[model samples]
Target: MRSLRLGMTAVLVGVASACSALGGDDTDPAADLAADLAAALSEHSLGDVPLGDEAQRTAFAELVAPLDEVPVVVDVVDVLEVEEEGRAEATLAWRWEVSDAAAWEYETTVALTQGGDGSTWVVAWSPDDLAPGLAEGETVGLRTLTPQRGDITGDGGAVLVTERPVLRYGLDKTKVEGTQVARSARRIARILDVDAAAYAERAEAMGAEAFVEAVVLREDDALDVLPAFRRVPGALAVRDTLPLAPTREFAATLLGRVGPATAEVVEESGGRIVAGDEVGLSGLQARYDEQLRGSPGTAVVARGADDVLRTLFEVPATDGADLVTTLSPDLQQRAEDALATLGAGAPAAALVAIRPSDGAVLATANGEGAAGADLAATGQYAPGSTFKVVSSLALLRSGLAVDDVVSCPATTVVDGRSFKNYDDYPSSALGDIPFVQAIAQSCNTALITNADRLDPSDLSAAAAALGLGVDHDLGFGVYFGQVPPAETETGAAADLIGQGTVLASPFAMATVASSVVEGRTVLPVLLPDHEVQQVAPQVPLTGREAGTLRGLMRAVVTTGSGRFLLDVPGEIGAKTGTAEYGEPGAAGDLPTHAWMIATRGDLAVAVFVETGVSGSQTAGPVLEAFLR
Candidate 1:
């Protein structure tokens, strides 16, 4: 009986201790209510909390609805106080991710109250609980502030691309009656020379207050159509400025274009870019876009029903830095002018000029024939006899001298392939001639006959020494020419004259001319500050060898096909090339690509025409005009 009484007493004591641990009587109702409110706010849900009625809960949800577009996080920093009068205050920390680079953060005091029963807690609903100073009927939104785009500068700090005045022509629907909207749009499109029916349909489909843009033209071009545009009832012209070069075609392919960000750009930006933001689309503009497009500003604002806005937070925009290049404005204009002489409907052509002394790319010009292609820097073609410069170096390395007697037969045969000189090859210079005369005359058979003096790899090695075959990333699109080893005897014969398996761009040929003048491998540079890496050739070119090559090139201008450049002012060294391509034409002969490389004073220039009679006939005049 004693043991049973002791066990019963012990069981009663354990029950009392468990009840106390569970806060049976010492629990603070106000503190519990405050903690529940904090949890509800953090979860952005009030369904599990006893702090608000159904109507109050709905109001709280509506107040935070604008935050759905952004990421929001909330935490209770402190439960400041709980009063006997059923009132309390709690500090809530709010964070909103506005963009990838920006966030909005602040602390706001939330008021809590106990119901009249003193057992239930309710939140005092107010817009300030969501954001400080927010009022009823006001909504928060994010606004982007565009930063000024940077300019592209050339040699001597000359602005190559800057914001210039332009006129935006469009059809304003509200200015005209609904029946006349399409007709007015058609008239404006006709005047602008755009697709009239398409533009008319677009204008009809837009909202009543919409302005359907027709075209953006330079200020000077707008003058011719302004009088006609004003006659239309809804036609309007808005003045604006955009980054532009001196003319529409001024280095258009290399400089690239800028316009509103596309969906792909927005998606790829990871929140850094948004719709309606201007961005680079190609070439140097796209290559270095981030460096040229600075950080944009952002503003978090609350807009009221009356349309008034109050800023909650703001970040200032940072302007972009200028991009400086090695181009000379005057020289670039000259090269373009020279190519312009080809007139309309001419074959594709390209010209590239480099300063031999420093390897600065002075000009890169593509003729109208290129049709917006970057042929000067990236077009690959058979270099033709201009490759003789590289082949000549290989032969020179094999102990052949400029004065060495070599046979320049009218035609030569190699491994069942019959090779012949150009049809216009001079009869007097045929038969036995000095090696220098063979180069000056561009004799195909002469170089093919001497192919026995070199191994297959010798050509590529020589090409590398002259900056022809090796590739380098100079911060832009460029092909530095290629000289692969010939696989057969016929291929070797053709490779000796730059025909079989050899390819080069005008940019590469210009580097070849530059190396000859600079007395070493000259790698062209477009961006002055970009780090240029050099790939050492297996056999580096020596100053003495370059000097000898220069003299031989000069002989061409004096006595060979390049005599066309003789009248130009300064002493010039030049080589002319005519490479046959494709199947035989109706004339029983293949089409030829014209090529010419020349060095005068500090400038080394290369000109190429896709289909021409000969290098001296087609490319020589262009080179002379640029030199003059």
Candidate 2:
């Protein structure tokens, strides 16, 4: 039925005859009509086309309304004159860019008829002229098909983050009266242990048909609140699945979280992401979001008045690629367990373990006290006496041997700043001790007294050799510690004992221990396929120097502060550190950071506590638990 109704009319006209009547050049009427029709469809405008009446122009606008959301381009393919007088068929190339990843294209033909005066032509309108097989009751729409989000895997290809069942609790405004929306929101908020007033206010401000979400909980966790939630007038608990780890705190800080895409994420995506799409929000998940999210499929579908859909064009979705890491599940659990010994309300703490042979990070765990911060890899704190591992190397490079004599007094002063050893320093080992004895006992004054033997850059240079200050891009957030050159005489003396601006993370200190075990500067690796960009130090550590440093660290466990670790099954080398912070005369006692680093066989480990009395008493037990 070619009725040419105003609501769905298609109009095209030939301007060549009109131009000829105005004393213009020669032009084929069919070709001019085809050109005019292509411009009319592409711009969705009928003002320039010669239509029979205003009704036909309005119908042309209605016909293109369904395609307003997408970009459209039309080109005239050809025009053929039919046997019927003053009649022709025009073919058009149609293209619609639906999304950044998909497009729809097809060819359709329309009939052209000459007017009674035979000077202009108009297209016989119908729905098929817009799209082939597009019936009178049908309209076009686009559908996005979400791809499967990839899983995060650990050592031995053990799946870490995968699809798990959960329940979304929310206030369904459509189910209740407008006045009862706030009441239902408050009820659900109370059952979920959230702020009732805030939830009620939010629900009251939303549209009548909105679903104000209260919370999302794992299926097992929702068991207690399910009955109470159902009693609310508008409450709904929708069951769904999400990518999740085995436990809530398993690796929350490092693995990150996933949720609906925020406005910022959508705007930054340029066109790849849209509203309501699930996306990674932070940590490793955010860093590798594109690889894990994959590409979405699109379908250009037509729906009739009966609500039946027919796909006009489609592109299949591509599933995301799995992310492989070097982290070990068993070792990661053990590390978290060791940190649990700190008990509730403990200060921030972290533990990091690495394989010296291959530089693989086996575990990186932050205690509950860290409050979801990746402190193991990004925290920066003064290293204290544990940095003597690097200082020992600098002193050894300055012509001092293990058997060489060095002074270790109860107290020593440099440039009017007085320095003293730990409170429990052994009186028997105080004066004129061997260099090895000073290292094993962590004698601060002994290292400070030899400060003049080293240049301003000596500490920084040696720190680089031990992999403390060298930076590497490991495909995620990381801090490799920092050692700035000392400018003042007192600053130089302080830097030797790791007290003046020397800072390191647990991950960086673990690398230091690993370097000693590997007999070179060892760079840590997390992602299996990421190529690390290594930064070389001015003077790299040698095999002989690492061997000597290992023997000195071993003596600490054999006879010095780390004697508690002697009962552990393997041969261990360790260094303990206690660094003081805060004003000198402010409080009862200045707080100290506890730190410990150790190596056994191919494994190197570091443990740090934000505040403690001593490294041996505080962080040492945690390290021992992890080793066992």
lDDT of 2 by residue, 191-272 (tens): 9999999999999998889888889999988999988888999899888998888877777789898999999999999977
Q: lDDT of all predictions, in order shown? A: 0.85, 0.86
lDDT of 2 at 567: 95
Candidate 2 to native Cα RMSD, angstroms: 4.3
Each prediction's TM-score versus the true structure: 0.89, 0.89
Model 1 Cα lDDT, one tens digit per residue, 509-567: 99999999988999888998899789989899999999988988999999998988888
RMSD of each: 8.2, 4.3
Q: lDDT score of model 1?
A: 0.85
Clashing pairs in 1: none
